[model samples]
Target chain A: MAESMTETEQRPSGVPYPGTPEGRRGTGDPGFAPHDGQEAPELLERSRALVDPAMRAAVESLPASMRRIARYHFGWEHVDGSPAAGHAGKAIRPALVLAAAAALGGPAARAAAVPAAAAVELVHNFTLLHDDVMDRDPTRRHRPTAWTVFGDADAILAGDAIQALALRLLAEDPHPAAAPAAARLADCVMELCAGQHTDTDLEHRAPEEVTLDEVLAMAEAKTGALLGCACALGALYAGAGPEEVAALDGFGRQAGLAFQLIDDVIGIWGEPLRTGKPAGADLAARKKSLPVVAALVSGTPAAAELAALYGKPYITGDSEGIARTALAVERAGGRDWAQTEAADRMARAMQELARAIPDPEAAGGLLALAEFVTRRSS
Target chain B: MAESMTETEQRPSGVPYPGTPEGRRGTGDPGFAPHDGQEAPELLERSRALVDPAMRAAVESLPASMRRIARYHFGWEHVDGSPAAGHAGKAIRPALVLAAAAALGGPAARAAAVPAAAAVELVHNFTLLHDDVMDRDPTRRHRPTAWTVFGDADAILAGDAIQALALRLLAEDPHPAAAPAAARLADCVMELCAGQHTDTDLEHRAPEEVTLDEVLAMAEAKTGALLGCACALGALYAGAGPEEVAALDGFGRQAGLAFQLIDDVIGIWGEPLRTGKPAGADLAARKKSLPVVAALVSGTPAAAELAALYGKPYITGDSEGIARTALAVERAGGRDWAQTEAADRMARAMQELARAIPDPEAAGGLLALAEFVTRRSS
Candidate 1:
């Protein structure tokens, strides 16, 4: 699929694909931050107080080798069990859960505490583990994949455990609505699995096999559902009104879609050194990403040529061909098409943000959080 | 491992050691008499009302290939879309769910309907599908495995989708306690995964290498958890007290363990012409089963010889050796040990059954259920 890369010049060179370390993006607004310098320690302190014990309890229940791999993935254990501060993820998803809940008027102190934070974090990790296995990925967060370490079965089982722990924590919470929260969480998990199934199916199909509608549906199932659930559950915790819960869910849904498109862009054209993933890795894998699909549908000469090359099965040592295909896709307006879509999605997300009736400042903070997610560089 | 067949009375001629159907055991307690005589038609009617719709809906959202395999496994489809009444399982577990809920004073009407029944059944099917893949089984329920028809990936994704559907159904139930019920179900799901991990590991480890304690733990994790969850959820649905819930869970747990031990016996000494699975199949696979484990710990000379024979990596074609090993294990008191253990476990299970304040008539029915499970013959 060929798309003109010339019109979209603001993109940074190197960022890892989604589900990787370099994929982390935050708001570009200079004035916006997760916390003021003074707030960082308290947030970290509070987070650690809750996350550590829950994580330990969950992992301890796992088999030894599985625990080892999970620990390594979480930056808690080295391959050889020596002390090592491994690359902990930014924990953005969990932070979003807390921030959204607090923004909905709950005390940040209890809203963002251990069990919830740990639940959300574990959900994120569970997805990472399974996604890596399905994609046959070998590295994540700039380290070897968990499957590569503990073997695929152990990795899968560990991931499954993390998912269970997420639900278990929510159920065990003493909140009046703990049961309802768990029910909501289970629905989101179903969406996650459905999204993944769609994603996996895309690989075996033609480049033009999936439509924009399908992509949107897939995004809703994959990324949007989780983010929306995060916000909705947060609002529930904060005792936010029904309208506010609905608004935040809408906001998260739109923002999550935009986030996925931006991440897709980064996967293809991003710089290898910065991303910590091989350059044009997505192209080499011939992933049926949005831009590639867009270009394939455009019917331009460049698109035709690119599609011709992609019609064949993927081969090793063909990264150069894949790169050329990527270039052709760019020349055909695919890149511009995706960028416009992402911006539109973001605008709608902000519109939803504006409809919220929470405290203006807290709402503003959540809005800033959304912006941070779509705009950040890894 | 060197123990001779002459040392034990367990060995019998005309009982195929491999490549022959295993035997089934029936309790002869006439447990299903009450339901079978008057309630059978109504149960089927009620089940069909819920099961048909839920089963259709669950697969409706899945991709075509996944749907195909699932439909095939459900005995709903063939390769050419011709009408095929596939081998639908006995649906014993779902019946247990409904019966347990009904026994706890819940109406067996909509409460015992499709989504929950289908969900539990799908969970069982999900396990079967994956177990087939892991055990390298080529057949299930007397037919080719799903993997044989749809390939490993499709079979896996199908199983995964069904699992998601199970959770989704539980979460979406309109009952007030649906949320908590779902959370409990997830706990069971996680335990099942843990059990599967242990079971797979046992396959790789020598049969005698693992201890009886470990085997019991594995059995509890693998089979008991789901049964316990099913019974507990059913009680929860019926508005049963926490005490009742705990008792039902205990009942299912003990019965499930006993079921496994009996299953192990069938796998070894079954009548080859009756059970679809090969007789002594577990022996050929050198599975680290209950009886095998018991034999290893008995400290008899025959037990020592059995251990040596089991240590060999390959036993696929050594049917004679397997028969000899089986006989030696019996002579060493392994068979007796296992039978006694099974009986003890069954007694314990029945003890739990005694705690429930079931209708005296229903109490006998429940006991019959337990006997049927643990002492079934086919």
Candidate 2:
């Protein structure tokens, strides 16, 4: 492990360590360590190669209608069953699975974790399909949402099928870790649903009636649980002991929170061309995102103004009002607060990763991925 | 096994055997064997005692918001979280689990199957919650549907949580059968979803476009798969070999088909007070139920008239049109076909049960339960 420490020292000089104070500033750039921008993509590509085939096979095993909907959702086909060169998701969770497995048990562990990686990806897509329907979002990945193309019932059933497929993939695996991994994944899904329930419930409440703590908890449950599950599953597949697995889980959880915090910030200020959504879409929908909740509770004059804007019954096509609310959130210190909180979470994630792997070289891809998640404009 | 066979011979004479020709008529009575009506109630009561608490515990394990929705859906509480005597569904799936275990491995097996029983019940309720929302039905079990009471998002999330809980219960079980049982249950859910997808898809097409074969296949997937899973899980927990487990699955599948066939008949003709919905509810919605599909393909004058009736845009609260359509369906031989098909399925179920248990007495309760399911007015 000590021999690998030199790898961290060799990182490019301009990129601040994610834990450093300079990295805590609202710098737009991720400034990833060393050759991460180049190296991480190759790693992710390799992980995707391992995971995508397995995922395709799983989806193929579904019944015909469900298979069609899943294929369409994954950008593998069109609504009319014609082949399409559509863009799939970034496969971030699968990359994490493989990286975590490699960190724990090296090359063989990475190989063994492929099924787990596929399972996690399937779960991620399942959530996306269902979430898109529940949120009534019209677009994802610069294309029409599955519910819009395939119809809501088909989309919902397809999501259900994919969830079952995830568990089936793990359960059918010959690995000794499969059963436990399935259990963990199921638990994570329950937490995800609970978080979603709270999220939509909060939408019905007055802005001031919601608390930052509640929103934070919801984010952890909704976003962090699955990421933690992916890491834990990878570690489990690597035959790591419970303590190491748990540490990796903690690492992923904090990293997930950091990712959500940054994502929330982007939801408010992201450029539409990059994010594939309208600018300030979250504000337009009056979504009680982390930053929005934080701003509402800030006790500043801007916060009061933001609350008053939220108090008005939302009218359709009120883009200007939504834009003003975004400005109010920023003026109330929500943007800065989210940035600082994300950096702190990244630091905590790094601490947990160090405790788990104890080798910075093995942890390189994980650190890069964490930076990538937080840094992306979309 | 031989001693048990004698118990079957001692059944009273007035109650017809489920396999008898007289039981195949549209008498609207179960014609249960011996003291089945009375004895079955006792068995169901005992099974419920074992399954309900476990189900409650599973629901309670969910987060507070989800727990509230689940409890309310199960009729254990009101919308305000106050206690209420609500009617949960007939714990038929759980009872099948316990009964199958008992038939296969006797008393100890029955006790060992408790977790499997609970898991199946949870899955059943999960499907019910989701199906209710998808169907947009306003009432279930003589009360407003969960979606009406808790909102669509909450109901959907609660349903999702229950499904996860079901898998969790099995995965966490110490029994050797737990992993396989969980896998089987997940597969059953996938099939159920596929069937639901097909059902909704068929609804979008002209009634004549749907074939009897397709309707039967959907019923088998939607209803039979879960029942089969329940029996297979029970047998698995009893440590039965694959052959016996498969036989029990066949038995349950056939019985489930019979139940569905009868249910389709009831949807057309059953009393509103007993069924807890308006009379001819399926007809009113222009639902492509099994009998209706069968009639559409019958090619009689009545079939054409029924098609014309279905072609019209359905108006809400048009009970007279629904009643006329129901009569047309009967005139086209749908009623007769369903009755014969149900009897055939019941016979097939009995044959499979005999192959598995090898003792008539061991099958008595199973036969009775099958009869009860097919005979119920509700």
Candidate 3:
């Protein structure tokens, strides 16, 4: 059993801390010690050490300038070229990949860890780069956007390069499911493009023109598809049965949608300083976020006034007005509605995992992961 | 032997005729023929039969608006959906793909024909779409550009969709080398992107600021890489030996470069009515064409006057002055220099093919193919 665990359990080194509650901060120790709540930390630490270099090597294969951008975006560098190594993200997406593979009966999941980790990270960063361009905002994770640093053309290329790298890394994996995983990843990428197209189109529309269902559809295609891909690829590496893959896909889809809902909520109501953003940032931009859409549909007096305000071009000092509108959404049950939906999604994800995993002990970390994503501040 | 022939021989297309001999008048047929010196009408008919539908399928994979613009650009439809097919292009690129595969050796080549043919055709169209955008040109072949009909965003997306479809089609091939070929195709795509970046960058630089070597490097990356991908992919599908693959890569690269040089010549000196373009188009745009570069280097009085003329910003009637400049290039032996270089490249390409392929009969068609590309009009 010990030998089997050595072969089957691991996380990438940049993952910081795996399976430990203390390391959940977006920043902390670069040294990760993966644990199973009861398992020895040394065993998990060794696994992470083996995977980290591989992840870096895969990322380094990209074009030099793009690699530099990715390195910075991943929080490995400060703007001034110093080694900051701030919060490098949760690594939850890749963890899902490795855990799903293990839950499925494949021992090859350990070998897949580096690529699995790198691919998800790349996908996340690709979105960030493009979203920054589309949103026309300057900073990300407390640093200048790649577009801001390298110019829009180079930033576009950087995103393109990272997307290509993700596909290439997955292709290079020796797992039997590499081909299918690649096709799925490509499909996910296309979905991202489509979802973004719709989002851009929506930006020009009136507030009342947007709907909750449309927001959900956009969220699924833009965010959920990639998360689903991560889980499906993990299952693929594990040689999971088709049923298991399907269940995990469902789980990931729900979890991703829920994640987006939480993000939307935070975008409107989270504390500015803690979020490293201005209050009511999405509202100030007149973004058709989930809660805003919900409020529009509710037909309250506040909704009517908000619609009137959104009809005009917002000027300076209008952010406070948008925050007042967000408050109306809270009063109108939009926040409550969003939170309920997230809880329902979390329940669905857990239920699917229960059905697919067979071994409940392996799933504890995933359950914690789901909670972490839904409730975390940053 | 019958089966082997079936594998290795492309039924010759009738005759190659594109537009008209006069270049200005529009002709329904692009002067397509069966094969060189072979008046097999069935071969021409079969080649068309194989290429047209596959090209349609490839274009249909794009988004609807993109498909509409692409169809109009291909001369398959008017902006309002009126019938308009004959003047689009000769589909020569796809024909070359099939011919190269058949000229190698394998029954599998026949199975690979549609996809390999489609791949090259899509790539060619992709370049045309982006070239139209980057060059800010209004027409291609003999009709309005896709961007003229569908807007820049749609045109860009159409080009992107074509690239994706080309790679996807190649990936679906069942040959053992298909995976490696797909990888090569992806690498070529990155090169194409890099070349476009370089071209866009050069747009802001003065003619004196652009170096000859930079022009050559950009040409190789943008044009030669895709052409090489087409040839190498065809050879791989045909189950050709490693030597043949390497030979095809060189053949494609050289042929592509030579083709570009002739294109530069035509862009400056060809009759506008015949070429469906303004005479001295490149010069009018103050483009850093080979002849222009030669004129810059020749140190003649006429060359200096031409440089002065090129130094001024171009307006509508500047094409006449550009033509006079092109005449200066001919007097300086630049046109002759370029033609001789083309011939040299063709000879070198043939030499590589000869060393790689021992079958004289099979080698004959490939060499003829090179001649057709180097000397092609319109």
Scored by TM against the true chain B, the candidates give 0.84, 0.90, 0.82
List model 1 lDDT by residue over B1-378, tens digit each.
Answer: 113211121221112112112311132322223333224435544555556677778767655646677788887777666768754765656666666666666465336434566677777887787677667788776778887876665666667666666766765566655666666766776778778888888777765568889889999888888777767776777777888888888888887887787677777776455556566777777778888888888888988898888887554677788788778767887667766666666656655655664343444334445555554432
A1-378 in candidate 3: lDDT tens per residue?
223111111211222222343443333434232235512223234334544565578657655545676677777776565777575555566766765665565445746655765676676677677668666778876778877886665565566556656656654555557666666665565566566656665776878888888888888877777777777777777777788788788778877877787777777776465567666778777888777788888888878877876776667787667767777777767776776676566657766766676444565445445545554445
Worst 10 residues of 3 chain B by lDDT: B4-13
Instruction: Kindly list the per-residue Cα lDDT of model 2 for residues A1-378, writing each as its tens digit.
Output: 112112222222234443443542333544545253336678778898888889888888888878988888899998789998864878888999988888778889899989889988988888888889888989888779998998777777888888888887876777888878888888888899988988887888989899999998998999888888889988998898999999889988988998888778767776456666566778877788888888899999999999998788667888788778988998898877887777778778877877887655567777677766665533
**Once superposed on the true structure, which residue ranges of model 2 sit more than 4 Å away at CA?**
A1-38, A312-324, B1-38, B313-323
Error of 1 at A377 (Å): 6.6
Candidate 2 residue pairs in backbone clash? none
What is the DockQ for all candidates, taken in turn? 0.30, 0.63, 0.20
| Clash numbers, per candidate | 34, 0, 25
The DockQ assigned to candidate 2 is 0.63
Question: For candidate 3, lDDT tens digit of each residue in B1-378?
Answer: 123222111211122211122211232322322234322333334556887787788667654545676687778888898888564565655655665676785435845666777767776776677667666788677677887876655565555555555655654555565566656666665666566667666666776677767776777777777777777777877887778888888878877777777667767776455456556777777777765676666667766776677788778876566667777777766666566555555556655655555453454445556555554444
Query: A1-378 in candidate 1: lDDT tens per residue?
Result: 212222232231121211223332353333323444213334445545556677679767665645666788787777788767754665555655666766665565345444666676777788788778777889888788887887777776777666766776765676654555566666666667668878887777887667867877887778888878777777667766778778778878887887777667767777455456565777877787777888888889988887888787668888678678778878877777878887777667665765774233455445555655565423
For candidate 1 chain A, which ten residues in a row score worst on lDDT?
Answer: A11-20
Alpha-carbon runs more than 4 Å astray in model 1? A1-69, A80-84, A108-117, A174-180, A208-212, A239-246, A311-323, A357-360, A376-378, B1-69, B79-83, B106-119, B174-180, B238-244, B313-318, B358-360
Q: Taking the tens digit of each residue's C-alpha lDDT, what string does model 2 give over B231-300?
A: 9999999899999999889989998998888777777776555566555878878889888988999999
Using TM-score as the yardstick, the better of models 1 and 3 is: 1
